[model samples]
Structures are given as structure tokens and as C-alpha cells.
Target: MLSTEADSHANQSDDYAVAPARAWFAFVMIFLLMLSDYIDRQIVVSLFPHLKEEWGLSDKQLGALVSVISVVVAVGSLPVAMMADRFGRVKSIVVMASVWSMATIACVFARNYSQLFAARAVVGLGETGYGAAGSALVNGLFPKRWHSTLLGAFFAASAQGAVLGVILGGVIADHWGWRAAFGAVGFPGLMMALLFMLVPDYKNVVVRFAPKVQSKSPKAFVKRLYAALTHGPTLLWVCLAGAFELILVSTIWAWMPSFFNRFHGMDVTDAAKHAALVVLCCAVGALFWGWVADRLSQRSPRNKLLAMCVLTLLTFAVFTYAFTAHLEVSTQYALILLGSFLMTCSVGVTTSTVLNVTHPGLRATGSAVLALFQNLFGLAVGPLFGGIISDAWGLDVALAAIPSIAILSAICFWKASRSYEADMALVAAVLRQEAAGERVENTAVLPPLTAAQA
Candidate 1:
């Protein structure tokens, strides 16, 4: 009987393999849902000029519309992700997608700034849980070797969605009206949410190798949450690095259309088209850099962190040149494209780092914690602060200054590299023990690394 049970365990471990078609299908569905999430969240940015002109709003007010969503998403991600961990990820994602889609459609009916603001907040509420849960689900479907590549590709959906949102919002708003843009992008998410219900989850496919201990008590839940949050010192530095990098990312996504319109004298649609191209570059960069990081990590894990740090520094330099150099319009666009591409290289790598250092059960919550810090410190503040600075000086000055945050981000990533190997080994040890049917107590705490290890 013991031999049979052991054989079953080994077979279950092998059952991690899924049909390529099914895996890709699930990937596409989740990717589309994520794409829709960003489309709903970011469509407002493309409407900034329209809203500003119609309402006679200031840049700060326009920026606040974007910031409000990030603020709410930052606050809501933790609880919503916990729900995903406890309940079902797929069901949670469907509900989330529906809520955001409905909220986005509600934007079409909003009559005043207050109404629109509330609608945007609801959109945030729906989106806060999706990324973390979606990433966790995708991770479970594939082997760890593919984590960075797949997650990088998965996260690239954000840039792709943002590109579509800005472009479609601009084109539709130009032809039909800004309100029509909202309804156009919002409805597809509802359908996508329903379609997502058909995809299978990891629990259904993979039989449990280790005993499943679903934490029923609040105390056990708290302990798990705490462990997830403090899994390693590397988590803190990675989150901080990602947060700092996002300041630049958020600023660009939020204001690139305005920047083109103001500086290049392009129309709304034209500006959006150009910005969409830049965002496409960002998507490509995420995949390219993620692949590069994974390859480098195969050589040595420390190389992954080094790659992020180097990419960030390069991004900063290119962006500084793009904004500060008094160059031709074509040259500026080329530089912006290069800068945008480099800026996203860290996204997949950082996400993979967080997942690798934490326990499997805490994957969604771990992602949520990363999102919480990234949104709160980066997304919430970047655009608003940039807008305020733009109002005081000029948008050009704001763009120039924002890239400097990459310097800090690079430093944090470099620091993280120093501790990453030790933390990774610790996580591996714990996972191995768990695989052998040992319960790991205080799994979050690792023994201090000796000088030799360092």
C-alpha cells in the first residue's frame, strides 16, 4: 500500500505536464482577460485631453483620475488576492473581470467628475485581484524553467492592452465620442470573463503529492500571510526596485499621449498612435529581457538580478537622452522607443524572483504584496507627482526628472543580487522538505547566511 501511494505521488508530480494546446489556450484566455483589465484601467489616460478640454480641468485633476485607480488597486489587492488563495482563482478572476467591465461601462453613463471617479474606483476594485491570481494560475500550468518567459509574456499583455486602449480610445473618441470608447472596450471583458470559466485550474489536474492542509483558522491564515510577506530579504529589495521602476513606467503610460500632443503638435489620435508604438516596444522589451534574464540565470542565478540592474541603468540613460537632447522629432521618437523598451525589462524578472523565493501556496498573495507596494509607491504617486511637477515647470522637465528614479531602482536591484542566491537556496530547501512530506514550521525565517555564502 505504501509503495502504491509512493508511485501515485511520483505519477502526480509527472502530471504537471499538460497538452500544449490546452496550455496555450489557457494562456491566451488569461492573457486576454489581463489585456481587458488594463484596457479598462488605462482607457481613461487616452481621454485626458478630451476630458481636460471639455471640463477645463487641470493636469493634476486629469492625473488624479489615473491615480485614483492605482490607489484603490493598491489598497484592494491584498484582500482580493487572499480571497483567490482561499476560494477559486478562476471563479475569482471571472467575478473580477465582470465587475471591472461593468464599472468601465458605467463610465459611459457618468455625468460628473464625482460619478466618473467613483466608477474608476470600482474598476480598480475589480482589477486589483486579477494580475496576482492570473500569474499564479499561469505559473501552476507550466514548469518553473518557463516561469520568467511565460510570465514575461503574460505581463506583456499589459503593455499590449495599454497600447490598444490608448489607440482605440483615441480613434473611437475622435470618431464617435469619448463615452463610446468606454463602452467599446468595456463590453468585451464581460464576454471574456464568461469564456474564462471553461479553463481548468491546477488543482483539478495535479493530484496532491504532499498532504494538503487548508488553513481553516484565522491564526493559521495570519501565519501564512506573514510568512509570505517576509519570505526573504530579497522580497523587500525586489519590490522596492520594481516600485521605483514603475514610477517611470506609470509616468510614461499616463502622459506619453499628452507629451506627443504638446511637443510634437500631433492630434489626439496621432499622439495615441505614436504612443501605442512606444507601448508596443515596451511589450516586446518585457519578453526580450525576460528571456535574457532566464538564460543568464541558467548560467548563474545572480546574473538575473544583474541583468535587471543593468537594464534599468540603460533605460535611465536612454530616457534622459530622449527627453533632454534637443533633437529632431524622428530622432526623439527613436530614442523614446528604445527607452520604453529598456524600461520594461525588469517586469518579468522581478515577478519571477518574487515567486521563486516564496512558497507555492502563497503565490497569489505574494504577487499581491508586490502589487501593493508597486501600486502604492509607484503607480499612485508617479503620475500625480509628475503632473504637479509639469504644472510647476513643464512636462519636459517632469519626464526628465522621472527617469532619475531608475538610478535608485538599479541600486536596489544590485543590492538584491547580493542576497538572492542564499534566499533561493533556502526556498529550495523548504520546498524539498515539503515534497518529502515534512511540515516546515516558520518557513519564512531563514538562517543567517555566513560570510562564505555571501
Candidate 2:
């Protein structure tokens, strides 16, 4: 018996030894995909001024482009998410990446605002699949213990992508025109997508709460989607949080270049440079939040989410003051940088929180629900609302919405925090019951996926 136990331990060690390399490879691939997604999204923002000038478009028209994409993304995320669960994550990622990249490249050939708008919508549809599929793949690739931390790294890549788009897009647009900028950013993602096919699915080794569960048929898929949308606090809270946050984030990213150029007396390229730096700071904040949350989870599972609530509350003040203040250009820049960084910390916090609370089998579905809220509320409304406010009430008034949204988000997260401890207790009880060979009802209330014996 002792010899058998020693052999089991040796085999477990051998299995675990391959995890680090797998985790790194998965992290790099997901990071690049996320980076590409953000870069694609940011291209519109960076080129807005040129597009507005060349096409003689109004703020409302630009707003429509933003709105249409978000709406499409929201609508597309669900079916794509279901498809991911039903079909295959690797296939979903490849297809989604190809579609979005090709669609974005099409933007270079668009002759009218309508054409561009349609292309952007297609890009959104592609993104819905990309996000859900990539996230599910990431969860499967990492050791269960490292999901949040690796996810944080993945989130950081997105921020880096945004920053690169702002900085590099500006330079590219200035040197070769906005169309070239789009073409350059869009084409590279296709290569990344192709490379992704080389990575095999690691879902087999990664423990899941529903390990033997098979994908639902289309009818069951639709039913599950509906159930997620209609019957749970999970969807509601995620949507609210995503909406408010996206609105603030998108609004700022989409229009900040124009705002800086107009208000600070800077050029487009210069504004882009500044925006890049600010976004880099946000990336740092996001990464830090993830690390902190993961460490905190060791002591209390709720610590991850609780940290987010605290950041949101604090950042609200920072954003309010930054937007409302009248200071020197340098001072204003510093304030904006600091405020945006603090606010972005919530990205990692919210993502990990949502993932942690959701059932393993429902990861793709949960991600879809989040995509809907994020796109509709955050992406669609945030930028368009900011633009409208800027047109009618001035940029200052428009940006004020960010702080208000942040405050509301803080409140919601705080309420969610109250339930975290109880949720943890329930999960622990379920895990214990399962260990004792008793049946557990709700799959969501189980121990962390990694802790389960396969």
C-alpha cells in the first residue's frame, strides 16, 4: 500500500510538472488574442477625427458606429458562447478571430459611413465568439489554482493592445492614413489566429465541476441561454457592472484623443501618445488587482471581489476630481493618468469575481451574459453617451457620467461582497458533502475546480 501511494505521488508530480509550460503557452496565446481585440477596437477611436473629417460625419454618426458595434456584440455573444460549449473552444477561437480580422481589414475598403458601420458590427460579432471561446480555453489550460492570476495577465494584454493602438495607430494614420492603420492592425490578428490552431485543447487535465457533462443540443442551449438571462442575479449584476464600467472606459478611449487635441491644444499624434501612456498605467493597475485578488483568495474566497468594491469606491472620487478640475496641462495629464489607472483595476477584479462565482459548466454561458452587458451597457452606451453629452453639454458634463456610473458600480459590488462569504460557506459544505459520497444539488456551490480529485 505504501509503495502504491508513493507511485501515485510520483505520477501526480509528473503530471504537475508539465503545467507551467502549458500555462505560459496558453497565457501568451490568450494575451495576443486579447491584445488584438483591443487594438481593433481602439483603431476606430484613434482614427475618429480623420474619419469625421474625411467623411464629413457628425458626432451622432460616429456615435451610431459605436452603438451598432456594441449592440451587435451584445446580441452575438450569447449564441457564440452556446456554440463554443456545444462545438469546440479551439474551433470557435479560430473562426471568430478570422472573421473579426477580416472584417476589420474590410474597413480599409469601406466607401461610406454605412459600409464602415456594417464592418464594425461584423467585428463585434466576431469578438463575442472570441472572448467567450478564449476565456473558456484559458480556464482549461491553467492549473485551477492559477486561473485568476493568468486571467489577470490576459486582461493586461488587452490594456497593452489599447495603448499600442492609440500610440501606433496615431503614428500610422499620420504617416500612411487611417485606412492603412486599420489594415496593419487587422491583418496581423489573422496570423495570430492561425497560430492558435497549433495549441491543443488542455480541457482534459483541467478539472471541471461537471467533468462528464456533454454539450447541450441547440434546443437545450437556447433554454440555458434564456434561463441565464431571465432567472439569475449573476447575469443582472454582471451586466450592471459591465455596462457602467464599459461606458466610462469606452467613452474615454473613443473620444479622449479628440478631447485632448481640442481642449489641451495638442495634435492628434501627441494626444495618442498621451493616451497610450495612460492606458499602460491602467494595464499595471489591472495586473496588480489580479495578483492581489488571487493572493487574498487563499485566506478568503470573497477577498477577490471585496477588493474590487473598495477600488471602485476610491476611484470614483479620483475620476470625479480629475474630470471636474481645471489645471495646467501637465497637472491635468497626471490626474487623468492616475484616475484612469485606478479605475481600470476594477477590470481584473470584476472578471475574476464573475468567473469565481459562476459554475464550471456555465463558464461560456456566464461569459456570454457578461459580454452582452459589457457590450450593450458599457461599450454601446458609454462612448455614444459621452459623445452626445460632449456635443450638447460639453465634454466635462459628458465625462461626469463616468464618476456617477462608478459610484453605482461600487454599490452593486459592495452588495455582491456581502454574499461572497455565504457563497464560500455553501461551496465548502457542498465540497465536503461530495467528499463524503453524498449528493450535492447546485454545482456552483462546489470547491474550487482545482481542488476536486479527478
Candidate 3:
């Protein structure tokens, strides 16, 4: 099946000239750094109890540690992605990894809650535009057909790192201390940062500017951003769908340990490990469904959004029932695992959807806009609100409420499906413009493509 699918994209052209061996090697390098990225980001979740116990902190404060990173990533990603153009993606990523890794290590020396929170924010700052830079580099290096699958692979790395972080944080904290857990995960990212420099960088896109445009002007940049942000109905709808789905996914990732510990009567380490195991299922599901969505899209491009919508509905059904029914603990865990799997159905495909409709020069910025929505509205909201609601009412209410967004997510994807073909036409015309040696400058803000031109 995989071989057959590989044959489908055999005609897709790669923009970069990386050797096959070198390309795969570069993927391995980037994949590891992405893994390291989440491990550092999520390791603190398993230490929430420790922080709460030691500092006598509120749940909101503990949740703030996780939410702050997403908030920072949301606000900083646009500017940070711009840096990838200036510094080069490979070099920028190396610097990003180094900063985040060092910040993670600095957590070990934090004496108060303020100090620790400051370090986590630094970690967020370092991670700001990594997805945008990394995705753009990977997209250019691989065939067009491979873009969505590779993106799925990238996000699978995120789930993989998260699982490891949650498990390691609990185990190390139990045996050594919470601080040691930080050191253990922190040091490896530094090593990975140095190694990431060995990966090849993609060639930059150089285009003649339109007479009215200034390449280096802040006004030019904002226009470019505005174009990407409001490119078409498909990109807008797809971005919203991905953001809504993350409400459930991030809430689960952030609160899984506490949920297991409280409801299942498990110890902190045991609960973290259990939650990590559930998240490992999430990684598997993301990769598997991503492959399925890709194959479905081969028959019809619109099938991708349809696939996402179906999976999201499945998530809502499973989660709503599991939380509301008086089921056994084992049964509940089983349902939650399935829910986790289905919740991220849109993750990779949505980014790919944005890429398909966006100008190649603005692909990184395009993905960052999705990141902006996902972080600010989805990831940032999930943990903070979960903690607040849990404090105000109960954890179960927060958990159950999060999955309802899946309904809205499905609706958005369905709406996006209607506009997919029209949006792809515009992108196709833009690609033709590039091929014809005509600069399609700021096409995002320009008039729609006619059927004849497309």
C-alpha cells in the first residue's frame, strides 16, 4: 500500500537539489530536534504536582507554565519566521534549539516560581517559529507529494517527544528530583542543536520585486503577511479547523497526568507513564491517519478535508460518551486513547492545506499563521482554561467540554472542502507565474485568478 502510494507522487518535483540520502538524513536530523523541542516543552507537566506541593502554588499558576510557552510562541512566531529568511533556516534552527535547550537547563537553578516561570518563557521564545522554519525547509527539500506525509511525520515526532517527556519527568522526579528531570531533557537538545547544523539548507527563493513594492520595507512585509493571512476561503477555514481540533488535543496533552492521577487512583509517576502511553497512541494515530488522508486525497484533493472532518466527529463522539457515561476505569482509558488518536486528525493536513494555497516564498509565514491560531486560540486556551475550570468546578467538566470543539472543527473543515478546488487554482496559477519568469508579487493582496489563467 505504501509502495503504491509512493508511486502516486513519483512525478512531483522537489525544489531543492538535496541527494536522496542527504534528504532523508536531513529529515532524521530535523525530526530529532523536533522531538527534543517537545520533550523540553512538555517535561514540566509531569512536575506540576511537585511544583504545587513545594511552592504551594495554585492550579492556575501551574497551568500558566505550560500556557505561557504557547502564548509566547503565538505572539513571536511571525517575527521569528521572518528571521529564518535572514539567518537561513538551518542556522536559525540551530540557534533556536541552543536557546531553548539552555533555557530548559536553567530551570534547574530556579529558586522561586518567578525564576522558573521566566526560564520557561525563554524556552517558549526560543521555540517560537521552529515549526514554520522547519516545515518550510522540509517542504522545499522533498517532493510536493511528500509534503503532507513529512508534516505528519514531524508532528508525530512532537507526540513522541511529549510521551517521553511526560514519562521521564515523572520517573526522574521520583528517583532524583524534578530539577534533575529538567537537566536530563535539557542537555540532549544542546547536542541535537549542534548536530542539526550538519543538515543541508534549502536554496532561497529570489524574485524580482514589483515596481510598487520595497522588499526590505516593513510595509512590504505586512502586505505579504496580510495576503497569506487572508489568501482564500480554504486557507482561512482550514486554519480555523486545525486550531479548533487542538483545543481537545492540547487539553489532553496538558492534563492527561492529572486526569489519570485523580480519576484512576494512580501515583504521579504511574499516572504520567499511563498518560504518556496514551499519547504514544496519539503519535501512531497521527502518522497512520496522515498516510490515509494522503492516499484519499490522491483520488480527490477535497477528500483530505472530508477525512479530517470525519475523524474529528469520531473524536467528539468517543470523548463525549466516555466522559458522560458511568463506565469502568479501564473502559474509560480505552475510550480516551481512541479520542486522543482522533482529535489530531487535522494537524498535518491543515498545514499542507495552507501550503497548497500559499505562495512558496511565504510558506513559512503561512504555516506560522496556522501556528498563531493554534497557539493562541487552541493550545494557550486548553491548559489555562482546563486548570481554571478544574479549580472552579471539576476536572471532568473541563475534560468533557474540550471535545465539543471537535464539532466546530468538523464544520470548519466541511466548509473548507467547498472552497478547496477554487483556492488550489489560484496557487496553481501562481506556480505557473513563477515558471513563466513573471513575478507574482504580493498576489495574496491582488485580485482572484480567472479560470482561463488558472
User: Highest TM-score: which candidate?
Assistant: 3
Pitting candidate 2 against candidate 3, the one with the higher TM-score is: 3
Model 2 residue runs over 4 Å out of place are 1-18, 204-235, 424-454
Q: What is the lDDT of residue 313 in candidate 1?
A: 95
Candidates by lDDT, descending order: 1, 3, 2
TM-score of each model, in listed order:
0.89, 0.85, 0.91
lDDT of 2 by residue, 373-443 (tens): 87877878877777777778887777765667877777777676667656535434444554465644322
Q: Which stretches of candidate 3 lie over 4 Å from their true place?
A: 1-16, 207-224, 228-231, 440-454
* Inter-residue clash pairs, candidate 2: 243-378, 247-378, 247-382
For candidate 3, what is the lDDT? 0.81
Each model's lDDT = 0.82, 0.69, 0.81
lDDT per residue, candidate 3, 136-245, as tens digits? 77776788778888888888899999999999999999999999999999999999999888898765543222344434456655554555334477887887898888
Write the residue-wise lDDT of candidate 1 on 233-334 in tens digits.
898899999999999999999999999999889999999999999999999999999999989998898899998888899999999998999999999889
Query: At residue 297, what lDDT does model 1 achieve?
Result: 93
Stretches of candidate 1 off by over 4 Å are 1-17, 204-224, 228-230, 440-454
